[model samples]
Target: VAARSPEPVTPSLSFPQRREKIERRQQEVENELKMWDPHNDPNAQGDAFKTLFVARVNYDTTESKLRREFEVYGPIKRIYMVYSKRSGKPRGYAFIEYEHERDMHSAYKHADGKKIDGRRVLVDVERGRTVKGWRPRRLGGGLGGTRRGGADVNIRHSGRDDTSRYDER
Candidate 1:
């Protein structure tokens, strides 16, 4: 007799359910981040002092476009855009490496809040390897972006056009 395999199950979540799920995941990451030690990681890449971590990138944004946008600050060494290994699609974020740390600093300060491909990308120095007790947004410890809807959502991570509060006359 031949046995049939069970079908895979996929659950569609409501808005609040998705929010709850995100909260739980964030909490788990928070706990894990507390014990993380970047020094022990053997697979670390890039020069932290000269690299800038950019997030909220548009998937359609290309490396050349990114380069052209960032080249204003200084000479760039590389642009490493993150992509999904399973799907091979852009992951909406990237790391831009500059030839000098001073260039990185300038970009880190001015590149943030600039629109790229119609999305305002968030820029921060590569603090994962340089700063102590630093946790990435995936680990729920970064200064920008969160699924939790609260008062602070508009505080540190306020750069997108939708969140801007310019006076309308």
Candidate 2:
């Protein structure tokens, strides 16, 4: 007697059914995009107007120029221009601290998306420290270790053998 092989299972949807499924998925994505708001993030809820992160700043932008521009809104507590460690040049970004929250909010509303020195600048409330989480990575290329504080592991050898080739002296 000959044995019969089982046929592979395939999706039984018709052409019309497949097209309807794709159209439904596309509509869901469009709805999600329409409902999304960048400024309504939960992390930016409390005391987010105290500090502002400015990006795409002109390289020739000076501290005095930044101060003069922002001073029109309110008093500034401090301005820190990020610099490259190797080149010792401005990194085209900075952190602006306001003495009052109202000033910070005013600066954020006015300066964001504004052009300075012909470069459009991006201004937003500074984000807090990122939450630590387990990030999975591919094994190999000298990256085969577990996360910290979990447990001690030896990846070089298996634990099946009890004896070593060398004697303990």
Highest lDDT model number: 1
List the lowest-lDDT window of 10 residues for candidate 1: 160-169
Tell me the TM-score of model 1.
0.63
Q: Could you give candidate 1's per-residue lDDT for residues 54-93 as a string of tens digits?
A: 8899999999999999999999999989889899999998
Residue 129 accuracy (lDDT) in model 2: 18
Instruction: Give per-model CA RMSD.
Output: 9.3, 23.3
Worst ten in a row by lDDT for model 2:
160-169
Best by TM-score: 1
Candidate 1 steric clashes: 0
Q: Candidate 2 has which clashing residue pairs, if any? A: none
Write the residue-wise lDDT of candidate 2 on 25-62 in tens digits.
77876666566443575533334447777889999999
